[model samples]
Target: MTPTTEHRPQMSVEEFEELERHAPETVRLEFINGKVQVKAVTDGNHDQIVAWLQRLCMQHRPELWLYAERGMKVEAYRRGRARPDGVLAPFGFAKGHGDWSEAEGVLMTVEVTSHDADTHQRDRVEKPGGYAAAGIPVYLLVDREDRTVTVFSDPEDGRYRLQVNKPFGAVIDLPDPVNITLDTEPLEDLAT
Candidate 1:
């Protein structure tokens, strides 16, 4: 038998898009698992880090496209959508707007850990499982709490089979989609 849609949203994707369209620019919200969650405000440091990563990714691969804080649908047991700091996909992926992109052909997703405890947990813990379940090849996590960048790759059975981490001052080597060594020396600790 063909596989069926295991997850269904409590609020339809159309409703989520409508809510986002009317919501204020400062307010960040996400339809996670079945409920709408008010996300934490993005700090200056977080913005800076995301900017730098996006720029670097663009420079490294001009053929591909990088989206900043783009929504993507990735879940196996619930209709959970996650908006990552940066999502690396093909050139034509932006054509599909105002809705969550299916997590296929997605190169990798970046998540810069924020200050809020809840947001931090969502990014560091919950999102990985969801992304992996959706067959996302790579999940890059920038943890400001410990000043480390962790790369989770090789998803199998809703979990990453490999994990590698580097401190803020070291060079982080990204495989596949972005086969380049990133200079993490420019990244500053948010605790300051």
Candidate 2:
């Protein structure tokens, strides 16, 4: 379920940013659904998956770059802040940006499920709402736990109108704005 902003936030956005800035390098922080969330550090396999996607993006869409751990202001009115595993945007998109960039011009936000208690809520639920609310075109979720790839697109009314899921070996086409087709066969060995 997409988290609702009905409840009061744990802290203001500025306060969250201050706490995040002082947080240790090992800890990644995100503010979503009016609450602060601790993001899990990427494991080796997770890093490999991101790198694999990075290579593919570079090859197929040379003008675009899959930026690793790029932070963005998500949710409606850009209230929530999230650091997606991979953020697909135009090359040099981060040139003049600070830690958190506006969601404008972002083609897609990618999240690879981590082995953590909140992975389901953070990656599958909250993120989709936040990204879609921000008008991001696509959200790609690589689920190591389920061994599947799910694509969320057609953002409308604070949610993705369409969702498509495929097993690791299947071919998945990331929809428009991020028009890259993926042969997820290479991801089979990297799921673990």
Candidate 3:
């Protein structure tokens, strides 16, 4: 379903803060291009990818803290609120605090693609730029149907210059912020 531009004014950091005070449980909102966009519920494939990534991160690197489907307010020259499918933060930053504001240093953020063309495009194209602008060093994308994981790194000029695409079973070296090596076998197994 296409989102309507109606209801409330264009999204701003201040406006989003106000809305957060009154946001309902059923409705999830994200700020995109100064607009509040509703996030759709994740499908099974999305859930699988998230789970696989989280599990792999935890098993390989127990020291790093990994968050799933949590709201992260990334402040760049332009402000935006994003909920990455998964985020890896350095250990001993801030534990037991669900608030992202307290957990400042983030190593990597991941997004799992859905069947929707718009969603896939946004995650693969727009979000990389946004995350890079926010100074997020690493961004991983898991494409379920394609059975591939794309790793984007070395953000420069609001974009990631390095793109590494690996099909199932390839080992991906997690970026500098976190020290860990993960294999894509588990993610590939999710397809079946």
Candidate 4:
């Protein structure tokens, strides 16, 4: 049997975008799992973690750029909007795109867990389903609480078929399409 769309978004994508645009600069908003979520302001360590990954991506794949907090239309049927910590795509892929760009050319989406109560549900659970459903090639999660990197890939039927996890200091291969290897040693330093 084919899959079905069980739930509708709390508001249309247009309404969400308009609301997001008018929000105060300090407040970040996201639509996920049919709810308008106030995304927590990232901490310094979170920013540094993204930066380290950005440098590594640029070093290994000069043809690609890791756009920070790049808004993306994600989830099945593009029902959700997320500003991933890092969005890896071909250089200049979003040159002319608006705030919410299609997930079409995104090679990978990364999220570094924040010190928020909602992080476990939002990042560890809901986000993987959303990114997989959007057909993104890979979802890389840097879990600060766990000090582990979990890579989710091979999306099918709105779920990733593969998942690999490694501790902070271990080497992790991000896989094809996003063929960058990470020596996660630096992550250990950033986890604090």
Which residue pairs collide, candidate 2?
none
- 1-192 in candidate 3: lDDT tens per residue? 977776434866877867865889776666755666666667786787787777777887887766886677663664777777888876655466554442258788888876665676567766788788778888988877688888888878878888989887899776677666778887766764
- Compared with the true structure, all predictions reach lDDT values of 0.79, 0.95, 0.73, 0.93
Q: Identify the runs in model 1 with alpha carbons over 4 angstroms from their true place.
A: 1-18, 189-191
Please give, for residues 149-179, the per-residue lDDT of candidate 2 as tens digits. 9999999999999999999999999999889
lDDT top scorer: 2
For 1-192, candidate 4 gives per-residue lDDT tens digits of 975655756888889999999999999999998888888999999999998988999999999999999999999899899999999999999988988889999999999999889889889999999999999999999999999999999999889999999999999999989999999998888886
Clashes (candidate 3)? 0
> Model 1 over residues 32-135: C-alpha lDDT tens digits?
66667677888899888888887887788877777888888876753677788888887788675655788877889888888886866588777888888888
Worst 10 residues of 4 by lDDT: 2-11
Pairs of residues clashing in candidate 3: none
Say which prediction, candidate 1 or candidate 2, comes out ahead on lDDT.
2
Per-model TM-score versus the true fold = 0.84, 0.96, 0.80, 0.95
Candidate 2 vs 4: which has more lDDT: 2
